[model samples]
Target: MQHRPTIRFHGAAGTVTGSCFAIETAGGLILVDCGMFQGSKTEKELNYRPFPFDPESVVAVVLTHAHIDHAGLLPKLARFGYRGPIYATGGTMDLCSVMLPDSAHIQEYEVEQLNRRNRRRSRVQVEPIYDATDAALVLTQFRPVRLRQWQEIAQDVRVRFWNAGHLLGSASIEMEIGQGRDLLRLLFSGDIGSGFKLLQHDPEAPAGFDYVVCESTYGGTDRLDTTDIGRRRILAQEVSTASRHRDGALIIPSFAVERTQELLADLIFLMETGDIPSCPIIIDSPLAIRATDIFEKHRDDLENGDLLVRAIRSKNVRFTQTVEQSKAVDFVRGFHIVIAASGMCEAGRIRHRLKNWLWREEGTVLLVGFQAAGTLGRILQDGAATVRIQGDEISVRANIRSIDVYSGHADGAELSSWLAGRLPVRYAVFLVHGEEEAMEAMARRAAALVGDEHVYRPRLDSAFRLDADGPVDISQAGPPPRIDPQQAGHRDWNNDYQTLLLDLQAELRNAADDKARGVVIRKIRRALEE
Candidate 1:
């Protein structure tokens, strides 16, 4: 019997986060990006469950970038007994050194809080997926690989990194497996960046592959084409409008890596050139502050490197590295700007800031990145009258503003163009990392480019057999899917429950009288009883 190679869609299939994939060959199994799930509580619960695959069997782990969704679960992989070499670019390795540890700290801290409440309620305690110590240990296994150079990771398996332009160290992984007549050429596009990104160059990759696993993050939406000056102008207007309220603060929920750095450079430039009024710009998250330092170290490699260096050195910018210092921002008077982490407002200091200022009409929440479905950021972006944050229902009175100019992911048109660039995908193009609608939209575009038969939309935990000709869907031949495909990217029961509670509160308040309110309550009680 001949050895057959297979590719498994372990994560980032029907959803946008938790990007893990397995490539199994005769030599061994190689895993790409063991990441953590974010967003709805149901989706997040998947993080605590055991990995569907055996970590110990993985011979190598290839990382694309250090974003929490793509690389967050690495420590958990380490905890599960995988000690293989993790390959990434030098920049990715450096960023992960700080990011992975921070993710671990967050898990430990959040778990501790949950356990404290559980103890009080006489409920069973839970452990974090991985701790800081595990995060630290995983760092030792990192093996940095330079871009555009092919390196052998396993027997008869070689990979080359291409600049993805998504983050500081992001890259697309191209692999050459087997030898001679049995050779397989595959490409995994790890979060391609929008060509219009302010701080990075356009995404780059080679063409001609047997199989291409691509991201469909911004598949259905197309942003207006804007030049660098135009992007800055939009930001300036937003800042200028918000700053007019001298008594309020502007809260920017930003991703700590590239997004924060890009905003800082643009904000400082606007201030120095008088495009916008100068104000105190506070970096509230310690992770953002530390990541900023790393960005500074590699400023020379970034576009507009001088602007970034200037922004970091600017006196108007302040970095709060301690808890006390972060808390002190609350007392600061006047119109100031704060950039905090956990960009989707899922966790981190941004939530605290939002809780404090969300109810103030004068305050403004400027969202500059992608907000995944079921996250607090998405809920606010969708315009909720009230949002629950850490058990407190806070009224949404702040000016909620969002701009697409700063998004890291390329929009639908760009993604289509990217797929076209990698033309003649002989076997198949597996679309992942997008919601159902976005994926469907991209599937149409992909079909036009590579024939409808060559486009595949894989579900979570689905697997495909790869051979000399093409891919065969062997999903049914394997174990059952880890999750229901229908629930992959949609808001789960937790979101529904929260929405119901809020709706009930509004109904009671708007009732004609106590009698009407009692009728509403009784109706709900009757439904519950049934």
Candidate 2:
């Protein structure tokens, strides 16, 4: 008898970052969304570790989207000698063309900064996970696949794409594996988008399948909205009011891709219709500006597409691609709006912009998307009075407000509604890509629809055996770095660096007032001198 088809949860089993899963069968090996681990500094170290499996052995790959957490590791995977073809939509490939290189630049830049500090402390220097050249190598492997078209990727496995409505070229992958007697259907919902998107359609519901893998981001509850159309009306009012009264800048920390373009559209529409006065709008993110070019190239592909195309071309909008240009904006800026990236506030020009604008009462920090836990964005959203940046504590006096209307992920209701159409799911339903609470809550809600026995939330690196009947847990070694950190669904890290990191993280988390701490240190030094 043939061995049972097995699936391994390599990444994204517990956390929202590092989305990777592998499936093995008699035909061969297949992988989906080899993404990088993200979030706190401790969590990101997982990206430096070797892949759980041999990259060269994988026959083919299907990328779900171009977001860093979903497709960021492709460059790293390729760097390790994986020469296989990567399957993605044209838009995904195009976005990755810019995004992967940008991620590589960050990796290189961060490593340089880290080493400079480490050198001062006489600590060992570390290498970046991947560089821009490595990212370029991965780009050569992407093969574009059109939406809704079925293409066989392996001996007995065929795959098709359906728009996920999360990001450009995002999709829900439907797969069929095996011959007449052993045929099995599986679906991977990469990231599901909700209604009220500015330019994209609603997420496509899953079709009938034996097994389904779904994302549970925003699983249990909903992000409260601040405006009707992605908070554009509110944004207009805030910008117009600030432009007229305060004469200070308005800063929007946005995701460089869809969020930036959507805001441009809404702002243009509002200003053109006399809803608000048109102040100079400066796009300070280099990545966002390149992505805008890609958006214009694909204008026909979006809803109200040409309108934004025209809006971006207008004289009031400025794309700052060089540091000189970005810096130049500050000199002439009076009541202008600066949109920057790293939506979660982990990195990017947004940090610099935030540092300069956050202290001014006249300026406002308008958060336009989800801010992950433990990130600077979340700290600001939680009303932090002060935050340390680049070794300096910065005051946070600028008004911080978030509007959830720009989110790309579906909420609890939308997830349930998406599943409502796929009633009577024939086999196991696995939930990944969410926090522990979210996954568990979604499990509870899904149990009411599907039998409790059929719903499974696999932990990171957990193994499962699948056949015609259903899926069952299998005993196997967990994925590499299977447990670590304070976040839910933690995998382990065995390196000494991790041990040292844990200690440092504890100190940071438990640190006291800076001035008082310095005084205490001086007192100890004086006592030692005596």
Candidate 3:
């Protein structure tokens, strides 16, 4: 008897980062994505753990995009000895060439800092997951493929790419396994873009599949559909209000790939058209600077590509590619707009900018994308009065604002519409890459289109068998999950410890006298004893 194909969920099952899936066939094994985890400490720690499966066993890797959460772990994969062909669109490959190396640099730099502290405290040292050499080596394995074309990746396995519209080269992968009578059709909706995106065309894909795996990033929420003009109007209002302060700075924490480029275009347009004051616009991220050049290189493929080209070349816009230049922004006087990277404020130059300006009443932090739970951006959005960054506690006196018009992921309604477009799913629809609530919410909406019995929300490390008829739940046969489902998207103990420290400081500060402070400390000591 022939062995039926099986798929295992390694990451992005219960949370919104580290998107990886393994498919096993008679030919061997292939992976859809090998992404890195972000967000909470628990989630990010999963990146340090070994991949659930052997890297050498993977025959090919079909990358959906270049986002760190979707493609960040490629260098680590290469470090672990997987050197097979990693397939992606030409645009995705271009973005990854720069992005992967940047990610490695961050790893090395952060680890270096961590080791310094560790050595001072007599703690064990930790090594980076991968280095610059590993990142550069992985690029040699990437093989670019065009959209809407079928390519045989492994024996009896053929794959095709569809425009996902989320980023420059983001794609929805379509696959066919086996041949003739025993063939199976599957589709992976790799981060569907909001249809109202300003940069790329609307997402497109073929319909009628045996099974489908979809993303639920914004599963339970819906937003007003903002057109390009409407989006620009909203941005203009924000810029106008923030720029009114002569000494204030407008700081935008953005993703380097798509969000940064889109913001630059709108900012430049608003400045040139006199809708907003012409303040100095500084691109303070080296990754974003390199990404913009890639965007310029692929301008002909984007909607209003000419506008982005013009915006990048605008005389008022400045690109700061070195650390010295980024630090020089601190000395610039008057009102200016600075855009930095790591949209979640988890890493990158955004942290430094936040540290410098978060205490100033005139400064403004404008968040333009989704802030996952436990991220600094979410903490700010949730109205935290103070925050700790790089071991320094800073008061959050600056105005914290957000605008959803620039989000790349589709909202709930748009995601459902995208799912509805792909009808006649014969087997099951697996929902991944979202929080628990989001997955549950999306499951309900998806059940209405397909039957309730046809939707499945697999936990991390869960595996399923795809037979000729439908899906079989074989998750128990697989290894246990690396992280508990309860802890996936939520804040970890580190966050709790930080909160405790802040609360203790506040309590001690508010004490009326030394006696009262001693009483507070005794209560804490008694609780610890208990």
Residue 161's C-alpha lDDT in candidate 2?
Answer: 90
Clashing pairs in 1: none
lDDT tens digits by residue: candidate 2, 155-199: 888899989888878898988888786788888989998776767
How well does candidate 3 match the true structure in TM-score terms?
Answer: 0.99
What are the runs in model 1 whose C-alpha is more than 4 Å off? none
Stretches off by above 4 angstroms in model 3 are none
Task: Name the lDDT value of residue 401 in candidate 1.
Answer: 98
TM-score of each: 0.98, 0.90, 0.99
lDDT digits (tens) for residues 380-449 of candidate 1: 9999999999888899999999998898998899999999999879989999999988999999989999
Give a tens-digit lDDT track for model 3, residues 1-530: 18799999888888898999999998889999999998888888889999999999999999999999999999999999998999999999999999999999999999999999999999999999899999999999999999999999999999999999999999999999999899999999999998888899999999999999999988998887578888999999998898888999999999999899999999998888899998889999999999999999999999989999999999989999888999999888999999999999989999999999999999999999989888999889999888999888888999999999999999899899999999989989999988988888999999999999999998889899999899998988877888788888788898888878877888898899999999999999999999
Location of the lowest summed lDDT over 10 successive residues in candidate 3: 221-230
- For residue 163, model 1's alpha carbon misses the true position, in angstroms, by 0.6
Number of backbone collisions per candidate: 0, 6, 0
Residue pairs with colliding backbones in model 3 are: none
